[model samples]
Target: MSLASTSLEYIAYFSEIVLAIIIGLAVGAVVMWIGGYDPWQAYYQLFVPSLTTPYGIYMTLSFATPIILTGLTFAIGVRAGLFNIGAEGQMYMGALGAVLYGAVSLPFFAYLPMEFLTGILLAVLWGFIAGWLKAYKGVNEVVSTIMLNWIAYWIVETMRVYVIPNPIDASKTVSVPPSGRLPLLIPNTELSVGYIIAVLAAVLMYFILWKTVIGYEIRVVGYNPTAARYAGINVRKVALYSFILGGVTSGLAGVCEVAGRPPSYAITTGLSNLVNLGFDGLTVSLVGANHPLGIILSSILIGAMKAGSRNMQIFAHVPLEMVQTVQGIIIIALSVPGVVRLIIRRIRR
Candidate 1:
């Protein structure tokens, strides 16, 4: 019975995903038509080669790495009964932590662990401030997190201008040291050990959230705070723990963006550098049904969009907003399970 129920759940999950994608595509097609673009050609150009070619695959994975970590951040927060909009701030702080530690000299092994931990710790503290405020002072997590994003953004931008501008390019920070960078998995590709790191983090989250006592407490608290309190679970502590854990993963995203991409070493150099990853994570988490494994697959799809959207205009003159429109429709379609269920019911009937 349990196995049958599980299989049924999996089927439903896959069904929602497929339906959401189709709806998203349908909406995207209408938008393309209105915008005077060929939807078929646009989508074909946008998706066909993303994973079919070597460079495309590498770029797709590279795009997936950070968002996967951020998706985990958001998904875990959902499980903990909190809406953590502060992953953006936590991500920035994490990158700052990497930069701060990279400035120092240490052994190869020591530098790697130390710098990565620094990112996690910094993000934890950033999250701790908001979590404590929410748990104790009655502050709203959404407002606090949004404010924190701007605060961290300007803080980093200010520091960029006055504190750590690169000697060669005053626009960006100094390069990360060789000891701190993640080695490439494939030669001459952007793919790095960050992919491995992200997968490991996902597995660990699944175990911690599903297979452990603490995870049980967190989920219980998320499901019903009042009940969990009556049951003697420390709701406040669990809230703090959830925020910190979310921050840790988001921070790791920032770290990977910094340390995983060598030679560049500077987050500022890239356009939209270290930005929107947290927002993208929210989309990814929702698309993945807030499951760790789901986030991995969702991130890949979104990543493919990211890598392939670049050529949309070149091949079909489809504006980049076309992709955003599809993603937004997908998120909206999935956000309300009622709609998905209704569609599924009609199909089954």
Candidate 2:
């Protein structure tokens, strides 16, 4: 394609994404009206808190950090033309691994690297297995990853409730040792150093996707495995590499939640908390056109909606279900091919 055509294509893709979000919001407003809720109240809750309160901003940042990582996970997989449905599982395993690290106390310098590395390694191993099953055994990653997520949930719960340092009253795991925790920068706030790490990850993702030879090969393979193979790219290796990258990104999300947000570990916490984020990552990936920087912004937008919803419920008397409906509308608009194509056509004209 000519440079001008390529540029036009990029514009069309981005326009589609923007249109999806707008359509999503419009659908959400309709859902609210049909549900007998005030659409103005719903919109206020969706947008107000992040603007009004410091705590809301802090929570928004906290929410943004992990979703950004998870979004990156899905984005990487999609870019490589692989459907990795196992990010939730990988995230759970990573959280479980981080909890294990939390069981022991180590000085700050030694603790940070060891704990982070452990989480990443565990997630990588899980991802590797999925990739191997897909590449060698011809199993579909979507199936394997979905099953893996269930296994992860059970394994983490079993370990937390029965295995390590479990006390009779231990519904929650013990607080992570102070040394194992992520350092806090914002005083008296939920915000932590994870935001910095998340930002770095986005920048790193951009560089890898646009600047690296390996990334180019991965994209080529995704575009067409036959063409990539003819060009001497190892399609299997690239797929496996994409799987590993996805796992690692999700792992980072797990570690950040355990180390920074909660300041400790809980049994099945990752699995439970990731209910929205796991799926939302797919939304973010779609909304952002699978671009790293775009994912970050999209994540922030969603995070703000989530964090602000509480205030809307408490102060504005809006139902929490309405918030969820809004999110669903957004996701559906992005996912449906016909809606997106129509939007793109309109924008192009």
lDDT per model vs. reference: 0.81, 0.76
Clashing pairs in 1: none
Q: What digit string (tens of lDDT, one per residue) describes model 2 on residues 23-119?
A: 8878888887888878787677667777577877888888888888888888887778777778788887777777786567677677668768988
RMSD of each: 4.2, 3.7
Off by over 4 Å in 1: 1-7, 269-271, 321-349
Top lDDT prediction, candidate number: 1
Candidate 2 residue runs with Cα over 4 Å from true position: 1-4, 51-53, 165-169, 263-270, 337-349
- Give the per-residue lDDT of model 1 (tens digit) for 271-309: 257889988888788777777888898888888887888
lDDT of 2: 0.76
- TM for every model, in the order presented, reads 0.90, 0.90
